[model samples]
Target: MRRDDLYITVPSLFRCPISLDVMKSPVSLCTGVTYDRASIQRWLDSGNNTCPATMQVLQSKEFVPNRTLQRLIQIWSDSVARRQLDAESAAANLSVVPSQEQVKVLVKQLDNNCYSSLEKIVSFAKESEENREFLATMDGFLDTVFDFMRNADSDIKLIEQVVKILDLILSKVSEKKPLLESSCLSTILLVLQRGSLDSQIQSVRLLESIAAVGGESKLKLAEKEGLLTELVKSISKDKDPRLIEASLSCLIAITMPKRVKTKLIQFRTIPELKNLISEPNTSVSTIEKSLKLLETLSSCKEGKAEIWHDSVLLQAVVQKVLKVSSKTTEHAVTILWVVCYLFRDEKAQEAVVSSNGMTKFLLLMQSNCSPAVRQMSADLLKIFRVNSKSCLSSYDTKTTHIMPF
Candidate 1:
């Protein structure tokens, strides 16, 4: 095949399933599956014991180099490289790509708030992957955009655009210092509170990104001035799934801190999360997140009281255990275990048993759940059985113990 044609239509067999790129070196696993060496090595390094393409558990980590496939790929790659060089030479004469100096100038224009400069910079960054990487490497570029948002006063449109640009820039840059600043965080919270819906979505997305990078410190900053409360309220009120997802993500990030978990309970986040979970047409992810948050909140006394106080919510949680994904099942079961083991509230225990929670627990033990989940299910079932017998025998005079209704 011609080199240019190879670029246009490389054989599917030449591509690594994991990287979805033309393979440089092919290796065969014990499963007799071929994959790119680097991609499979990284996958194995990440502790994966299953074939990425076949989803079959690997019998061994050993990989045999496929020299024949490697040679074929090398020959094809050489031909394609030669054609790419010729094409690049031809395109170089027809086009004038922006220089690093020119991009720096656009970056300066962004700092000065030059007319249409933000739009131009955003356009340039989005023009190609190379441009995005170049912009990311520009010193102080992310900080300048962050400062623009922080200093934005009366210009809502300007703030919105800056946030939009920040979102794009964040996707390219891994730097976290600019995003962790107090002024930048306050600006993002303000946007979440007062900006338009689109801007609010962008701001929440930016907050999620910051939380991912900032870890515990950023989470502490997020809890300031009832920001976490506002996030829960947004999740409860926003009809947009995207916005709700972002808000939940931010909440999840901050709730990692124990103090923040207690603070979220103080914010009465459980009721709102319960409402969100009960909402019709809610996505599984939203429901899963709500349950996960509840799992965290339930670790505290206030959270347990709040969850048990609402029988409907307790029943809903029981129903969610085996009904959703395994992760969701884990979270739901953990919450139940916490409440049942720590508090040992008879009413709550009775509520769960009556809701067929016992049956669900048994089903989960037999189903595909994590060992921890099954163990919790067993513990809960044992507790429920003991509690039911205690309840029955405590009232009845007979020697026989009957299950509680």
Candidate 2:
């Protein structure tokens, strides 16, 4: 397609966001991107590509251009210009060609092809960091990114491409927090809002990301938006084991401090959790997850002692761990370790530091535990004996392991 033809066709194809017309020059801008070529380039030159809307930072390596299509566009423009001059001359002197409209459509198709090529090229440019030539380009690029993320579902192909790009960006830079805080994070949240199960699963992973790259602000915002709770419940409610495990892992990361960690364990005594802990279909990973959460709660100086204050809560946790058969070691080791640490009062100590704790461990050790669980159980017994002189001898050997967990 000739350059003139490209002008006709390209705009119709790319669906330029700014002008709501065909992309002419097609430049990404800061305030709003432009389809005019000169404007897009000027924006790039001015370092406006990183973010048009929010002015966030973006790496230039993100973009990669298609050179073959670039050459085709140049040739297409030359042909169209020559053809146009011929048509205008012929129409002035005689009847127009029967195929004039067809020619226009053909030209438009070429332009669409050219514009598609440029889109890939610019996307590459974003990835390759090739356009990081100036801060102005970065500014425009970021603006462009916000536009795409906000309209991610504009095209199915585009959605797949954008998700791919997001993965790359996340992998490339660990500190793209500002970009994330803008529409990118929101887009991911929207994935949760309307996406299928796979998308929902992917959405929960953003929490792990926020924990890694963001501080208090973004996470708090996400939490307040109910995304955090949504993720937690997704794990608890999902029938798919893989999705359940992912939610569990995300929850474990989120609850690392007293202010956060205590909430999940707070429901330990609740009727809901009591039922969950007793459900036969629960996976080992999920139970282990709860135990790890408890460990985090126990280790938090501010929240550790509160577990014992509510005897029902304490009983719920202990009873849950003791009832486990297949998922026993994980539950036993984690609960033993955490309970021993947080069981505060003399009665609590009698439970945590007591030999009965050792008995629980000893029973679990006799089960089909792996070396790690057995080792941990033995270690817990030794620690209990040393701290509170509680041996595993409180109950008769035959009946001890049989008591209500």
Candidate 3:
């Protein structure tokens, strides 16, 4: 467990071929093939008699412990643990403004134990804004980051660490846009798809920074394969609120392109957005963001058709009006107006009406919402009134009403 060994990549020999993860218990079958005991046992229990890597049918199933490889794995595991402790220690030792010499030592360690060094740097950066500004101005720090991005190919762990570091300080680094080559973008997309939750959030924030450059960089991000898909996928599932907010923020930042909106629709972003808006305990900011994006999506023809037909989604959008902030009400009203009032979709109008949406519109008009929102609410009320076969007088303007369908 020498200090230098901590910098080296985990030996391929130490990894189980079946799982490609580091083997905890190395064992060998009679065919002279080694495997992690658990992985091989699972294979054997599943009725496989052939060697997984070599594919030779096994004449014998008895296996013995590879104590030598086991010992090596233990040593490697211990060294990694020590490196993590050292990284935490190094990050803790830095002052309010880390001195140049201390920064230099950490930067130098990047060529060795990059995972640990990155942990140290990100830990320190997270401590305070002044520390982030200090690190951004520190010479050679950006160079190290660019080098990692350029060389990052299949090392997911390294890529995850580097993306987290970049997300923290890229905004403060002035020369950032020029340094973002296509490979760096590809690396970011990879992390967005497969990295841990923290890495995914960092990837989303980094994409936001790139999109903010405005022009070719933004266009390039919008066009990257799997970038938009992954972004949509992040919100399509129930995730940590922070990741959802970051993904939503990034989507809002990059959706200026019409095709981006279309692609988002193709990826089924609307229904997930409906789920978000419908969730009772969702934060006000998240609901606002969800409505804003949904409002943007409702502008296109397919978006209109999508919202026009899904009654439940329409109900969710209707529920947001006057139920959240004024901004949410505004976005909600605009979306409803486009699908129901402007386009004159009967089903869309009915969905809103059926969800007590008539009352929401009634309340929105009375509230001091934006003039446009009030106007739209007024218009929407007219649409419902004109189309209603139900008893409209049951909708009490002074209080709640049970709409008799």
Rank ordering of all candidates by TM-score, starting from the highest: 3, 1, 2
Cα-lDDT of candidate 2: 0.49
State each model's CA lDDT, in order. 0.74, 0.49, 0.80
- Descending-lDDT candidate ranking: 3, 1, 2
- Candidate 2 lDDT over 94-147, as tens digits, reads 532223244334334433553453234334435344332321233344344446
* Model 1 residue 354 distance off true place after TM-score fit, in angstroms: 2.0
Off by over 4 Å in 1: 1-102, 111-115, 171-174, 214-216, 386-405
Query: Candidate 1, which ten residues in sequence have the lowest lDDT sum?
Result: 396-405
Q: How high a TM-score does candidate 2 get? A: 0.46
In candidate 2, stretches whose alpha carbon ends up further than 4 angstroms from where it belongs are 1-146, 150-169, 214-223, 262-276, 301-334, 345-358, 363-405
| C-alpha RMSD of each candidate structure in angstroms | 17.7, 22.9, 12.1
TM-score to true structure, per model: 0.67, 0.46, 0.69
Position 377, candidate 2: lDDT = 61
lDDT of 1 by residue, 214-326 (tens): 56666656556756767877886334567788788878876776678777787778878887777555778988888888887887677888887788888888888777577
